[model samples]
Structures are given as structure tokens and as C-alpha cells.
Target: MDRSNAFVLVGAVGAGKSSLFNVLFDKEEAALKTQAVVFETGGMDTPGEFFSHPRLYNALIQTVSDVGTIVYVHDGTDRTCRLPPGMLRVYGGKRVVGAITKIDMPECDPDFAERLLRENGVNDAIFRVSSRVRETVGPLKRFLFGELSDGPHACGDVERKKA
Candidate 1:
């Protein structure tokens, strides 16, 4: 596996990173607790612990070291951001995008999630999607698969659909 050409998912616990991973990879099984890093076809799924715990920062850094891109998953219904300050700076050379998940949930606030993601350091394309909704995930999948063209929108300004 030439991980340098792949992408990796990172976020706090319950941010739906695993669910997005399963959806992106076309896995039919339920998402399980990601106790450790799991490598799949196009990307890698990282354990949230590696991101939320300061002590595990090294692990997270190492886990994504080889990947060319980083997808930071944020729960749309949550108001908090667990991404440590200057954490993403470590990967200055990697393409860091954002994904606001759970937009299908009634309580989700994608606008706030997008604001939080921007405040944290996701200056690239930010995708808002629901794992259960294939249509919503299309743009992201297309972008990741090198099929999405940079249409009228700039990188960080992609609007998410409201449920």
C-alpha cells in the first residue's frame, strides 16, 4: 500500500469518522470502534483517540504522515471542536479538507460546524454531508476520486445542504 498517495480521516470521538469511512469505502457492515488505525482501499481510518488525547498526538501525526490528504470530520450537531491549536500545522504540506457530518440529523447545524472548521484551520474544500445520504456525499467522493471540477465555487466556500 503506497499510503503517500492515499488520504486519512481524523476527528474527535463520535464525530462519525468511521461511518464516513465505511460509506466512502462502500463497506456494508456497521461501523465499529476504531481502536487503531485501519487502512482500506483509498484511504486510512484513524482512531479518534489519536486525535482527542494530547498524549497520542504523536500517534496521530505518524498515522497520517504518509498520506497526501487529511479529512477532518466534525459532527454537525456538536458545538465543540477538539482539534488542538497548531495541531494541523504539523502537516503543512498535506491537503487538509473538512467534512461536517450528520447533516441528516434534525439537530445538526452545518453553518456552525463550517464556522468551527474554518476557525480551526480547514482552509481547503469543506464538504458537508450525511453518511446515510448518498447524494450529499457525492461531491466529496467525486473530489476525492479526482472527478470533481472546480466549478464556480472556491475551495473553502462549498455550501452544504440543509436537511
Candidate 2:
């Protein structure tokens, strides 16, 4: 698996995208509010405005154009699905997946978030994770980097497994 191409994380505001980005890259520093597209090793962290505002969709599109994978992060506690219709379909050339973030929160309903992602066009693997929990991040990392023994790498059209 080529780990050189970055994976972009997109989601609504306060969805824990940046936190997951830090975890994925093993960054010990605190994740601050993402005001714009921030490029880092292995992944790209995007601001929530790009995903939530239609006018900024172009920015989101441009940000992900070069990435090999697009991980759509969703807040588990947020019941609403903010994905515009066919928005993710635009990235036909990239691998699209879903991550229900902040699942460790007491009010988080990962099941609902998963259902919302499915209904919103995320047909790939959907992982339930908490950025602060090391255990939860491992599966996602393996899935993203293709470290799983069952498949070559996730960038390939591998079998979709729910995490």
C-alpha cells in the first residue's frame, strides 16, 4: 500500500475530524479549530464550513481532488445528516468511507449516525470511533492504510467491512 497519498477528512463542524486527524498521524499536540484546509502528513484536515455550506462545496471539492481517500466524519451525537444529495458522488475517482466520530460521548448514538451515513450515500466501510480512545482508532487506521491482512490496502476496491 502506498502511504504517500494523503486521505482527506471531511465532515460537519465539531465532528472531531481534526482530532481524528491527529490520532491518525500520531500527533501529540492538541487539535485546534480548523479554519481552512490544513495539510499534514498522511492526511488532510478540512474545516466544517466546507462541508456544511453549499457555497464552500467547491473548496471541499478542490481540497479532496488530490487525495486518494475521502473519510466522511460525522458526529455521533448529531442526528441530522448534512450531506447534500450526490455530493460525495462527485468524488468518483476517490475511495469514500464514513467515520462516526465521538462515539465515546454518553449522548452519542453511533447506530443512528451509521444509518444516516448509509442513507446519505456512504456505501463504503463505516467505522464507529472515538479519537481519544486508542483501541477505537486502530481498526480505522488499518482500514485506511490497508494494514488488514485480509486485503492489500483500502485504496483498492477491497471488501467493505463495518467497524
Candidate 3:
């Protein structure tokens, strides 16, 4: 797999999209209140505002087509889902992955977030992770590195079995 093209991340505000980028790529870019699209070495972090407004969806779609993969992040701590059902199908041209962030938060329920992601069309692989701890995201890291298979194992429930 080509590692040059970046992975684009899109999600609701405060969903830890930027933080995930930092954790995935080992960067210190703070997930401050982002108001516009921010590009990094391995990922594209879009503002939650883009998800809040419908007009920006076109821009998101365009960016998704240009990337190697699309990562849709959900806030595990927030039960309320901001994305429409099966939204991943919209970016069918690119690989789509789901990530449940804030897994370590007080109110987080990773199982619920995982279900929400599956129901919303994260067809390739779904990852449950806490961006606060890089090691907790091993499955996702492996997948990004093309070392982990994009099968049921990508759910990040069990440890990846050796080939």
C-alpha cells in the first residue's frame, strides 16, 4: 500500500480527530478548536464545523477522493451521533475506516461507538482507540502500516493474530 497519500479524518466537533492524527503520526499538533482544514504529514484534519454544516460536505468529498484513506472519527463519550447513517458509502472511491476516540473517557462505551460506526458504513475496518495513549491504538497503527489485515480483526477487539 502506498503510504505517501495522507489519511483524511472527518468527524463532529471535539471528536478528537486532530488528536488521533497526532497519536497516529507521533506529532504534537494540538487538537485546539479547529475552524478550518489543517493538513499534516500523514493526515488531513478537518474542523468539526465542516460536519456541522451541509454546504461543506462537497469539500469533504473532494478531499476524500484525493487521499489514500478516509478515517471517520466518533466521540465515544458522546452517545449522540452526528453523522447520517451509512455515510461512509459517500466516499466509496476511497478506503474508509472508523475510529472511536476518547475510549478512556469517563462516559465512553467503545462497544456502542463501534456499533454506531458499523451501522454508519465503515466497511473496511473499525478501530476503537483513545488518542491519549498511542499504544492503545496498536491495531490502527498496524493497519495504517499495512501490517494488519483489514478484516474482522480490524475491529480492534482482539489482538491481531500473527500470520
Candidate 4:
């Protein structure tokens, strides 16, 4: 897998997206370095920051298309399962993998995660994770770097696996 491949982290506020970002970049403590530069093996630009604005979804889709994979972070504690329309439009029907964040929290619900994804039209590999404990991130990383490593593929394989 190319190291320079771009991976977008999508999640609600305080969902530990930044924490996963720090881990993937091998900068567990590097979040403190505001001016730090990230390097990728594929010679692609460093990963971009997460954006909630609908206007930026188009740009993000273009960026993801140019990259290798995307890591979508979902807050397990959030019951509404509400996804940003821009995100749904950008990632819908794509091979993006879902990662449930904040598993360390007492309120986190794994079952609800499946329901949330189903309702949000996310029919792909969903892994429960905790950025704080560093658990489940490895599987997520492997999945992102494995089957999802390719750009623009059918989400059917992932959906069938879940089914």
C-alpha cells in the first residue's frame, strides 16, 4: 500500500477523529505540534482537516477520489445517527469504511452503531474503536489499508460481508 494515500476522517464533534489522525500519522503526542508537517509515501499531499460545512463536501470528494482510502469516524455515543447531508452525498455508495469512535465511554453502544450505519445508508465494514485506549484502531487501519486501499470501487463486497 502506498504511504502517501489520502485517508479522510469523518465524524461528529469530539468524536476523537483528531486522536485517530495522530495515531495514523505516528504522532500520538504530536497533536501538540501545531506546525508539524505530515509525510506520505505515495507523494500525495498530507491529509486534510475534517470539515462540517456542506460547501466543502465537493472539494473533499475530489480530494478523496485522488487519494487511496477514507476512514469515516462515527460517534458511538451519539444516538441520533444523523449524518451531515454533505457527507452522505459525498461518501454515499462509496467503499468508505466506518469506524465507531469513543468506545471507551460508558454510554457507547455497539448495537446502535450498526443501526446508525444502516439508517445513514452506510453499508460497509464497521469497526468499534476507542482512540483513547488505542483499541480497534489497528483493525480499522488494516481495513483502510487493505481492501479499501483502492480508489473508487464497488461497496457491494463490503455490504455483503456485513449482511
Top-lDDT candidate index: 1
Answer with 2 or 4, whichever has the higher TM-score: 2
Q: TM-score: which candidate is best?
A: 1
> For every model shown, what is its TM-score relative to the native structure?
0.89, 0.85, 0.82, 0.67
Write the residue-wise lDDT of candidate 4 on 1-163 in tens digits.
4333555565555566667777655564734321222334422221234345557556556655644455566777777654655464554434556777767667777677767776776666677776665545666666655544534331211111111
Q: Clash number for every model?
A: 0, 0, 0, 3
Error (Å) of candidate 2 at residue 3 is 9.4
- How well is each residue in 122-142 modelled by candidate 3, as lDDT tens digits? 767778887766677788877
TM-score of 2: 0.85
Query: What's the residue-level lDDT of 122 in candidate 4?
Result: 65
Locate the minimum summed-lDDT window of 10 residues in model 1. Answer: 152-161
How far is 159's C-alpha from truth in model 4 (Å)?
A: 28
Cα lDDT tens digits for candidate 2, 27-103: 88888999888876677899999877899988888887778888999988899987767878886777788988877
Q: Kindly report which residue stretches of model 1 are placed more than 4 angstroms away from their true locations once superposed.
A: 152-163
State how far residue 118 of model 2 sits from its true place (Å).
Answer: 0.5
Stretches of candidate 4 above 4 Å error?
Answer: 1-5, 30-51, 86-93, 147-163
Clashing pairs in 1: none
RMSD for each of the candidates? 3.3, 6.2, 5.7, 7.8
